[model samples]
Each structure stands twice: as C-alpha cells, then as structure tokens.
Target: MKFHLTVDNWTVQKTDARAVRFDVFVIEQKIPVELEWDDMDELCIHAVAYNEAGQAIGTGRLLPDGHIGRMAVRSTGRGQGIGAAILQALMAQARQRGDTEVVLNAQTQAEAFYGRYGFSRDGEEYYEAGIAHICMRHVFA
Candidate 1:
C-alpha cells in the first residue's frame, strides 16, 4: 500500500487527525469521547497519514514541550509502517524545533513498539482512561 503524510498545526489538519483519533481512540478503544480531545490540539503540531485513496489512515502530534501523543493508525493500515512513519515524522519535528528529548505516555501493550525506536521506560506502569500506560522518553543525540 502507498501513502503520504502531511505535517502542520491543528488548524490545517484537525479534521483528518480527528477522524483517525475518533476511530481508534474513541470508537475502537472505547475511550470516553470527552477524554479523547483537549485544548492542547490547537497549540501542538499534528501529522496525518493518507493512504493511496486519500483516506486518513494514521495521525499523531508533537507538543511544543517535545511531548508526543495521540498516535493512532487505522486497522486496515497497521503493520505497514504507518505508525512508525507517523512517529518518525513527529520526532523529526521535535528535533527541528531544537527539543532535546521527547516524551509520551505509551500504552503498555505497545511499549515494545516504541522501544524499537529508542524510547525507554521512565516510570512504573499506570492507567490512563482505563488502559495501562507508562511514561517513555527518547533523547535526541
């Protein structure tokens, strides 16, 4: 499958990002609708992945403070590097902004996925929106 990515502020890509997040985090994961959104979106940089058909398949964001969150890839797009590409794009954005490190509260089940990209566990596991998560960090070299 072929796809492309777009990086911009929420103002430019909120619709696309919101769709993927709504599907993955809200409907699919059963996370409360209210908990899936926050004021930070407008202030953060967002990235959305579009498949060959132009459907939004994945999305993620990088905050000014170098925190990464809301990473999601649609079910049909998984295992094809969509998630990795979204993550790398956000990390590159952080580096371009001169951030020394990036952090995220990764769902425990996906810890190893982030680990493959050099993110290390920073604290004990905890729960977020009823899902197990842990603090993870990756320092830029």
Candidate 2:
C-alpha cells in the first residue's frame, strides 16, 4: 500500500497524529490515557504517516534532545513499511537538526526491528507503562 508522511510540530498536525497514537497506544495497547500524552508533545518534532485515502496510519516524534518516542502504527498498517517510513522521517529530522545520535526506549519485542535500522541496545530492559522496553540508540556515521 502507498502512504505519505508529514513531519511537523504537534500543533500543526495534532488531530491526525493524535488519532493514530490513540488507536495504537491508548486503545490497542491499553496504556493509560494520562500516560499516553505529555507536555513533550508540544515541544517535539512529529512525523505522521497517512494512507493513500488520507487516514493517519502511523506516527512518531523527535525530542529536542534527540530522543525518539511515541512511535506507533495502527494494527491495520503493520508490516506495510509505514512504521519504518515514520521512523526514517523522524531520524532525518533529528539529523537535520544537527543531532549526532538519536535514542528511543523501544518495546523489547521491537528491538530487532530497530536493530535493522542500525539502532543498538544502549541499556538493560526496563518496564515503562507496564511494557518491557530497552534503551536503544542510532549514531549517525
């Protein structure tokens, strides 16, 4: 399936971005509504992927400090490269901002996926929002 991505601040694409995050994180993952959102959103650089039909299917964000978070793709959009596109877009944004490395607390199950993108484990696994996650980083070469 064909999809497009938009990289912008939260305020500019909040509606579409929120919908994708809400469906994946809030609804499917059962994460607490409160924990799913934070002040960081307004301060981070957001990347949202839209289907050919114009529906938001994936999203991610890059913090000012080069931390990547809130990476998500709706169930229907999994395995279609939407997540990779979103991550690549955010990584590009980080590099454009002069960041040498970008970090993320990836769900342990996804460690291999991130690894394929040149991300390596940075620390021991830990639980966040009740899910097992491990710190990972990709340093631009």
Candidate 3:
C-alpha cells in the first residue's frame, strides 16, 4: 500500500508532535510517562509527520548539540516510510543549522534501520526505561 506522508518541522510543544510521541512511546511502548517527557524537549527542533487525512503519524527531534531523539511512528503508520520521513526531516533541519554530526540513543531493534541512514553504533548497549538501547552517531562533511 502507498501512503501520502507529509513531514513538517515544529516545536516540541506543538500538539501534533506531542500526540504522535505519546501514542508511540508512552502508550504503545509502555515507556513511563515521566521518562517520555523531558526538559530537552523545549530546546529541540521537532518534526511531525501527517497522513493524508491530516492525522499526526510520526515524530522526531533534533537538539542544538546534534542529538536526535524522541523518534516515534504510530502503529498504523509503521512500514510506510513515515519513520524514515520524520528522521530525514530532522536531519535536514540539522544540516540547515550547520550541524556537523547527529547522534541518537537507538533502541536495539532499530539499530539496522538507523544504520541504513549512515548512523553507526558508537558505544556499548544499555537500557533506558527498561528497553535495550545503544548510542549511534552519523557524521557529515
């Protein structure tokens, strides 16, 4: 099936971005509400993906220091490239801001997905909010 996905940059405080992340991270993944929301949110540049019907389907954020985080795509949006679109949008924002590198703590299951985007595992695996994760980084010239 094909999907008409639109990714737009927004502040983390935006409702659309918050909705997507809440569904994917907190509700679906069982991440604690406390851990799902953090102070860095206010300082990051966020991207929210919308479907043809104008529903938020995915989200991601890029911090000023080049850290990418809070990437989430709703269950209904998975396997349709929405996640990749969100990541690309954030990466573009990073590039436009003159960032030389981007880093993220990726869930172990998603290491290969980020790898396809040139992100390499940077350190040993660890757990965050009860999920196995590892640090990954992508450098730009």
Task: Output the number of the lDDT-best candidate.
Answer: 1
| lDDT tens digits, residue span 1-141, model 1 | 899999999999999999999999999999999999999999999999999999999999999889999999999999999999999999999999899999999999999999999999998999989999999999998
Please write out the lDDT profile of model 2 over residues 28-98, one tens digit for every residue: 99999999988889999999998899999999999999999999999889999999998999999999889
User: 2 or 3, which is superior by lDDT?
Assistant: 2
Ranking by TM-score: 1, 2, 3
Candidate 1, RMSD to the unseen true structure: 0.5
> How well does model 2 score by local distance difference test?
0.93
| Residue pairs with clashing backbones, model 3 | none
- Highest TM-score, which number? 1
Ranking by lDDT: 1, 2, 3
What pairs collide in candidate 2? none
- Listed in order, each prediction's TM-score against the native is 0.99, 0.98, 0.91
Q: Over 4 Å off in model 1, which ranges?
A: none
Compose the digit string of candidate 3's lDDT tens values, residues 72-137: 888888888888887887888888889999999999999999999999999999999999999999
